[model samples]
Target: MEIQLVGITVLWLFLYGYLIVASVDFGAGFFAYYGKITKQDHIINKLISRYLSPVWEVTNVFFVFFFVGIVGFFPDTAYYFGTALLVPGSISLVLLAIRGSFYAFNNYGAKDNNIYMFLYGATGLLIPASLSTALTISEGGFIEKRGDKLVFLAKELFTNPYSWSVVILAIVSVLFISASFLTYYADRAEDQKALELLRGFALFWSLPTILASFLVFVTLRQHNFIHFENIIVRYWWMFVLSLFCFIIASFLIWMRRNYGTAFIFVLFQFFFAFFGYGASHLPYLLYPYVTIYSGYTNETMGIALVIAFILGLLLLIPSIILLMRLFLFDADYVKGKK
Candidate 1:
């Protein structure tokens, strides 16, 4: 009925598209590793690397562009939207970059070069540091109100809670980076002893990242952290559900022999995350900052959503068909493997 409502609906539908693509791709990757598919079958690796991986990567790029375009259209809303997206988007980007770098290193035999290894390790650390800094600034801890203007003083910025969050994030980031390096070195050595050590490091260090993310969400909710009351009301339940799903999925992943089971669990995790995010931020393109009613008010936008929803179903139906074909007819690829 209104422009803001229509815009919010379209944005959320786009996000659903993104979640579908991302979950499938991420599930495929997890199965590839869990099933040791790469070692057993080149076809499986090729399917993942050539098809699924690119799909996720392209989708991620589109996600970035989609938000960037929205912000461009509504400059006044950019700060709030950017603040909300900074932490999660940056985490995904950095993790994907590290994974991509690892793929390149393996493909090109950069493992033998100590300089290359050093650079890779340094890049990994830098990703987290840069993200932490961005998240801190985006959280608005340094801004001082001076009658319709926000000013940042260096001294205030340094002493803010955002700064402290950055420090904590940085510490966790280093742990993760170190874990990655350890795993890389272990792989290069091909020594069972080294691999075991690295695996332990990875498992231990990974927990902190998860914990930190949970803490952030918890604090956000406790403080009524973000703007927009409706988002807080609807999505708070979803976040709670997501935390439960994460714990359950992590346990299932540890115990399950069938990699497909673990893959499914991971998809559920993503689905929960998507639902929480979308539901919480509904009726507003950007929470705490911009609302749908304020941005645009055209019936055309509503019609567009109806049309897009139909198109989404069309696309989704075909994907289900293809997935069924793979599940039933392509048994050779997954059977006894998971």
Candidate 2:
């Protein structure tokens, strides 16, 4: 029974995982393009601007297809997957990776600096990897029968060729770090005011990521409590950590004078919280009553959800496209208006 249940979990996990990745890619592209324009970089900025509309269009289409897949073909899947829930979760992971990568490659690598590069790289990679791994493992493929002890799926992913990909990702991440840091710090000595503002902005943008770290840690602890025995002080520590994260986020927002940083922080925090909320009640995709596989197999509701999903995609796509266009071409017009 456990094995069968695990198999179903894995299937749903793959779906969620893919959704998360897609959302993250879309979000990162949005943020990156917007950030470049704000920094007044014309070369790469122009290039991203041109492509923004198309990217948004693609994202919208993808979501529509995803929604259709969920609702039309697998109405029962809704009980496990939920509407657009995994989108934010996956996107958050991608944004983290992009942030780390931007810091490593752009900030640290260009100057041949390694410490900041490593710090950001590790933070970015480890957190996303851990989440992805946990999700994958919970789905059931990596559980090995080793004398009643379950070896996690993450351990397996790390051992496989995927580990090599991580090394490459590390390198790319460092490059992005170096680029971003160099750009920010290049004129810092010449422009003290700008530097000060930038620092404040950095802190503001970081609030969500900081809070996310806490949320992820608490989540892991919760999972351990459910699956394993003898884990101590799980709920108590989670509450403490959550409070700390909230305080830090509030403080950063309060201190921020720049709207850009504050906006990014708020947006990221929303997604982070959304994902965190969804994940908190996992192993039971449908709360209170239906488990992932047990009670979610009704065909009629599945078709309705699929239609809803498709409609959602149609709406989301155009909005994303318009947003990209605004960022790429009309960002200057919108900057202070908001």
Candidate 3:
């Protein structure tokens, strides 16, 4: 009900947007390359390329909005997370640059460069792995404030079990989310070959996604008991629903029916879990460092930001849907009739 809560909820929605869109973009790159190596490129690469061509340019818009909004709405995050995120943030940026170069090179320069494809595929996984550090660091053990300086324990982060677990989850979740959506997208395209291939990918990653989730929860109990307790007591229902959605999604995918419906369930699966984790971690943007109450901007600025982001969301969601209608889901375009 408070401005801070509302602000974060909106930001969380943006981040969720980034998660789904970018996962599809990222996993498409990996699948694109995987299809190549597996000698199945002729089967699904066109489908992947079609999905990426229009959507890739906009995938990061959600992320850019979230990054700016977090700092705008919670200025304290800048000081607390800035230094702590330096290396991981830089790694992600570099990976992003490499991934972007693939777009340019594949489009104009070298359409079939193996080196470029490798970078494209590698960054697909690497970016998410590096970015997941923010969530891991957020569980609140890797940063220290001493005297007048804020220190980031890079070694501690690398060595942390929960950190690795979260990274693993991010990679598998990216693949899972991407494959699920792409399966449906392939089905929409009526490319039975691609649909079967992507459906198999979706099913393969399903169990690993759930397992990685449990590993994070188990590791959370030891890594940050307070947040873990919050998860158990306050937000367990969200996770339960997440699991249920996963079950429905997996069953449908396995049954090879209603691909679109299955992917929607996959989205809900993560929506419940993601927001639930976020809701339980409420108040604190970074444990022991920044709370939404303590970190929020002043009321006037906060209201301005909230409205701006809401408008941005309103614009973004419709733009994507319209894009789908115009290009992605167009009867001609999707089926290669055009």
lDDT of each: 0.47, 0.40, 0.94
Q: Model 3 — which ten-residue stretch has the worst lDDT?
A: 107-116
* Shift in Å, residue 154, candidate 2: 4.9
What are the RMSDs of all candidates, in order? Answer: 8.5, 18.1, 0.7
Evaluated at residue 67, the lDDT of candidate 2 is: 45
Predicted candidate 1 versus true structure: per-residue lDDT over 57-126, tens digit per residue:
3545435534643554445556554444455457757776765665467446653344433444344344
The stretch of ten residues in a row with the least summed lDDT in candidate 1 is: 34-43
Ten residues in sequence with the least summed lDDT for candidate 2: 174-183
Ranking by lDDT: 3, 1, 2
For model 2 the local lDDT of residue 186 reads 20
Of 2 and 3, which scores higher on lDDT?
A: 3
The candidate that wins on TM-score is 3
lDDT per residue, candidate 3, 52-86, as tens digits? 88888898999999999999999999998998999
Backbone clash pairs in model 1 (N, Cα, C under 3 Å; residues 3+ apart or in different chains), count: 3
Off by over 4 Å in 2: 1-141, 145-154, 163-296, 331-338
TM-score list, all predictions? 0.53, 0.31, 0.99
Deviation from truth (RMSD, Å), model 3: 0.7
Candidate 1 vs candidate 2, TM-score winner: 1
